[model samples]
Target chain A: GDSVTQKEGLVTLTEGLPVMLNCTYQTIYSNAFLFWYVHYLNESPRLLLKSSTDNKRTEHQGFHATLHKSSSSFHLQKSSAQLSDSALYYCALSDRYGSSGNKLIFGIGTLLSVKP
Target chain B: EAAVTQSPRNKVTVTGGNVTLSCRQTNSHNYMYWYRQDTGHGLRLIHYSYGAGNLQIGDVPDGYKATRTTQEDFFLLLELASPSQTSLYFCASSSNSQNTLYFGAGTRLSVL
Candidate 1:
């Protein structure tokens, strides 16, 4: 079985502050694909960043994450946070080659609130 | 852009009632999925289909049954709903199992 964990259920920060949302995963397979999906209020959840290669930082919309196979983690980080960045972030794992085909396992999600 | 549309943005039904959530993807993707969002639980996969007439059980499929009648259409059925079934449901489609998923606006279901 595969699973994702997001330890921080809520992370509030001031505008312009650094943003770091923790994410870790566990799977029996050696090769893993991790993803970050952002969900805004009243909007459909969309992909923000996806792991390209292990240890290679993948970034989009000022957010970046690196998949560390050694630690089984793909933590999302931003140098500065904006009020618009406030949303629910989910870390997920793609079990493409698993017995059940390509299924995505998501964490509990972290609500990132940025205040001015 | 990929588009996934779900009907009945809000639904309310009593326990033991029958409910069906519909989804259609114009992207013509081979894979479609049904997920439920709950507080402290994030999004949990209920069921998915890769193509017409195909159905695969997901992490939380105990109270759900899914049908893929066409390549663009997928449906989630709750024959006998329960209170615990109340949640926000999202439908998504991807070109393949490994690609990025495009989600629908979501349906909020309340089982009283």
Candidate 2:
């Protein structure tokens, strides 16, 4: 069984500040893909970043996440938070050995609020 | 611009009523999935299909039935809707089991 965990339920920050959303996972597959998805107020959730290679950092939309297999963590980070960065962030994990389809196991999500 | 469309943006149904949520993807993806988002559970997989006429039970498929009639169409059915089933439903499609998913805008279903 695969599972993902997002420690922060909510994080509030001021505009132009640094941001980090913790994400961790537990999986038995050797080739596991970790993903970060951002969901806006009225839009569908979209992929922000993903990584399968351990210790490699993936970056997109001013956000970065590094997959640390040793720790089973793929935490999302941003150098500077923008007002538009406010949204619900989800961390997911998928393995290459699923019998049916590539099903994602998601965390409880962290709501990011960037204020002016 | 991956296109995944879900019908009936908002739906209201009574307990024990029948409800169907339709999803269509123009991406020609080989996999489609149904997930429900709730306050504390995040997104839980309900059902998924690998191809036309193929169905697979997901993590939470006890109260849901799904059908994939074509490569582009996937349907989720709730034969007896319950108040516990009220949540935001999302439809997603991917080229394969190990690819990024494109999601629809989502459907808000309320079972009273």
Candidate 3:
């Protein structure tokens, strides 16, 4: 069975500060895909970034996440956090190559609070 | 932009009642999924469909039923709703394996 973990339940940061949300996973499949999703209040979560290549950084909307197979982690990072970046972030894993229809296993989610 | 819409933005039903959550995607995505969000469990897959007339059990499929009538529509049914079923429900659609998912505004369901 595959599982994802996001240790931080909430992270508060001031605007313009650096940000990082830790995500780790445990799985048996090779060449797994990792994903980042953001959700606002009362809204469904949307894909923000995705990657499978280990050590390759994927970036979008000023945020970046590099999948590290060695560490079994795909932590999301931002050079500068903004107020608009406040939302719930989830880390997901999938074994698309295994004929599982790419079923996803998501983390508990990290609530990011960026303040001015 | 890809659009996935869900009906009945909010619902309140009594215990042991029937509840249905409808979802539609205009992007002709082959994969559709249903997930439930709770305070502790961020989100867990309830059921999914690969294509029209295809259904699959997910991580948690105990108290739910699903139907895929057409390529564009997927419905989740809760025949014997319990207080534990009170949570936010989300529907998402994806085109293929390992593709991005577009989610609809979640529906808030409260079982009293």
Q: How do the predictions measure up, each by TM-score?
A: 0.96, 0.97, 0.96
Candidate 2 at B98: error in angstroms? 5.2
TM-score of chain A of 2: 0.95
Residue-level lDDT tens digits of model 2 in A1-116? 78999989999999999999999999998899899999999999999988898898899989999999999999999999999999999999988643447788999999999999
TM-score of 1: 0.96
What is the C-alpha lDDT profile of model 2 across B1-112, one tens digit per residue?
7999999999999999999999999998999999999988899999999899999999999889999999999999999999999999999998864478899999999999
* Top-DockQ structure, candidate number: 2
Candidate 2: chain B TM-score against the reference chain B: 0.97
Question: How many Å off is the CA of B72 in candidate 1?
Answer: 0.6
lDDT of each: 0.93, 0.93, 0.91
Sort order, lDDT high to low: 2, 1, 3
Question: Model 2 off-target regions past 4 Å?
Answer: A97-100
Q: Which stretches of candidate 3 lie over 4 Å from their true place?
A: A97-100
Compose the digit string of candidate 3's lDDT tens values, residues A6-106.
Answer: 99999999999999999999989778889999998876789899998989989999999999999899999999999999999999998774353767889
